[model samples]
Target: MSAMTMLAVGDIVGAEAAAWLAQRLPILRDQYEIDWVMVNAENCSVTGSSPIDGFGMTTEVVDMLLTAGVDAITGGNHSWDGPDVDKVLAYPQVVRPINVSEARGQGLVTLDGAGRTLTVINMLSPTAALPGMRAPQPKPLWPSWTELAASTSLPGAIVVDLHGESPWEKASFATALDGRVSAVLGTHTHDASLRGHILPAGTGYIADLGMTGRLGFSGGGFDPAYFAAQLRGDNPHKLPAYRLATGRMTLGALLLRLDASGHTKAITRVS
Candidate 1:
């Protein structure tokens, strides 16, 4: 039996949090002996209300993850913040799936490491946030997940990063794939959920992994005055910009002890 110490972190906003994580995550890994770490980098770049990154910070974000020894990455609506992100996705080691057609990255890949072959799949759910996009559409992401789980092409375990906004969707999908996948972790909403637990069939699950970057602020990283101005319907206030604290930023993950059959014997969410 091999223990799969997988860390599925929340959405990371910008480089500042990355800096913080570089120092903090290793400590946690040492304390827990984590084997693999994956994070949601949807907001790692500065983008407006769209899914595309306006700023070309995806490369830097990925570099930070690599430096932090993260095994892979998955993102939500903001994965396509900039055109440059497509270039980074071409690296093959990275996984980014678009619910819509013509997305840049692959939704599924296999990782062989730590005496096990782990298959990691990334998917997006069609919730209210994703307009004009259909769940399991373009190429049927959810069904693809099931197919991958049932495939014999890959050995070892399976880890899925469900990037979506709806807790219901995440939970429902997780239940559907239970016993097939080793772990089902969710991202987006910037707030961690209390729904993570080991199922009777040994599948690990969570509603969301929470946010890694600035949070509890009105805007992504704006100061109080600027946030207030925007709230008051005032014209763009030119006051000094503020980089909100990462908040009582919590890093969450499902630690599972899976046997050779990809069955989780025990699962725990590191507080």
Candidate 2:
């Protein structure tokens, strides 16, 4: 194919947002003539097993996304949160962060669609760590990109979800790989950055893609109380149970147009 369009979505908050996305994503795909779709679903399972249904890529959620036209699913810092993460990691269509030493499954998955093949890479930032982590932030154990790239034969248009915190590290990483891959989209920050642009060498870059969920201060997933208490130096154990924010659904995404050689010709913000 001379040109292909790939939709890279930001982190999803809860089941409500996931289901809603399933219903409407196909329409967007059709509208853009999208050849591939990748979504960050680390937060998708944060709510646990509830009436709304939650946990890392539940079987039902996987089915919904698959049937709804999603080609690949990527994860974030919450990759190893619960037993659910293990389950999703086994599915060919789902992937967790590759940089995590102990993350359950492969960080990269090859997706065949739109009359061509594409490789979806999911990896964490050395600076992005959650309470679930056994190590500290900016951990030095992260493997170098040169080493990672040398280890694999990226045969198709490569789209990477560089899930991380530091804008410098993420941007530098993407910059170093310019022309070697299609796009390196950042996630983890729930607020989208306005820096979506193609690198001088042709790889598309963005600091953060925000999120696809309810519009709110607490990532549209939880009520403001939890984040407020945490910021006030309140004891985390004493914080009230997280309250789900019920607000208007919103989408944060980027549309990448890649040429036959896998260099992104354009990176358009589609939020």
Candidate 3:
């Protein structure tokens, strides 16, 4: 049976990270013989001049990634960060969280990759420490995703990017979608999950794909010292300005192999 490979990238931390990826993604793609590429780009644009924070993706970076051969761009809690983000969301190939808002943008995208049709969905759990979400998490996955699948003329191999906080919750969600989707990949936490494996029902599952930014910091690519001061409730005045860590950029993602029917044949890390 013929098969194709997809590279699902982890959270990108900043514009530099995006630019860095645009330069080297082709090498990674060639190295893996990858057919399609998807990225969790919510953090591609960092906001705030003081007490800085990860917000949403920017247009330039998104365009850079797309030019670098990224087939799909997925968003998380940061999807609604600002008007600039709205422009990013409106990109034809971008997929925002389905439950967030239908009027905002599409929740999934169907693309032809390597001569095969593929469906990609981006989902964000409401209770995931998102800035504006309410106390109770808004879960529209079960019936909602199933409903969307039923209504759309989707290809057999569907991949879901479940951006959530809790690991077990992500696992359970993937389990529920096990036999139906081709793969369920988790993001949000920057660390790579060691559990990349094919489920009994033929779906590929991984707790997280990790980050495509600098590693070894408490907050993945941010100033850990500043983050610690905030956590300790130190005087905001005394803390240094927050900034992205300076280091060698790294690529974090997964290489998934699937057949025409969307059954995962192999799963491995691409870092």
Candidate 4:
């Protein structure tokens, strides 16, 4: 049996970043012999002031990713911020947070590639304390994971994207599921961690995959001026226009190689 490879990208910021990714992802795939590509697109649309208003994605951005050879797209807390939330939810290749109440999108998705099937699960950790952000904290996620495992017979390799702000939660969750899944990747923190390694059970893990967007900003796509204002106790509702960072931009992704039996063989990070 042959090995299967997959590349999972970090959070995508805006149209500019999306376009950059679309143009280059195919190249990266072929170069790395990747069988599938997954991306986090919760911030693909306009960024709003409030959590609800700021986290939606647009259909155009999703299409761009699909057209660029992305096999699946995962979303997080901001998954519902776009204009056509219903449409995004209906997409089979897109998965939203499994713990979000009344969320319209699937929490898990499966794709066939390299003569094997790969199951991808998207999850968000319980909300953490952000200095000026007000977001909902969901219930404990282990119950949801248990329920999912009981209900579904996960086939082939399993990849998980834990979008969260707390390092402790992400690390703990990944460690707990080390032997069960192929890879447990952390997203949403925007900065990549150097903690990529394979667990004792052959599962791959990372604290965060980092972000893909403009280089010199807080979260990659926000205007620094507006962000500073917010940090200064200004109203979030008075957010300034979206601004892509000047100078250079960067793309970050994690590549995983799995054996025929669905055990991780190697984990590589691409930036």
Ranked by lDDT from best down, the candidates are 4, 3, 2, 1
Clash pairs, candidate 2, are 45-55
Superposition error at 37 for model 1 (Å): 1.1
RMSD of each candidate relative to the true structure:
4.3, 3.2, 2.6, 2.5
**1-271: candidate 4 lDDT, tens digit per residue:** 3579999899887778889999998789889988989999887776565444676678888898999999999988777665788898899999988776755668889887557789899887875323333334555779989888999877778999998888778878978998888888889888888758888888888888887888775655556776677579877677665465665788878889999877788888887
Model 1, span 34-142: residue lDDT tens: 7777777766665343222232246776787778877777765555555466676775667766444545677667767757677777777655234432122334557
Q: Which scores better on lDDT, 2 or 4?
A: 4
Q: Which candidate is the best by lDDT?
A: 4
Q: Per-residue lDDT tens digits of candidate 3, residues 54-165?
A: 4577788889999999999997777666437668878988888776545767888988744777789988775464443321234566776777777877664789999887
C-alpha TM-scores of all predictions: 0.79, 0.89, 0.90, 0.91
Residue-level lDDT of model 2, residues 80-118, one tens digit each, is 555565577788888877765654577788877555778
Q: What's the alpha carbon RMSD for model 3?
A: 2.6
The TM-score between candidate 1 and the true structure equals 0.79
Cand. 2 Cα-lDDT: 0.76
Q: Model 2: which ten-residue window has the lowest total lDDT? A: 134-143
- Which pairs clash inside model 3? none
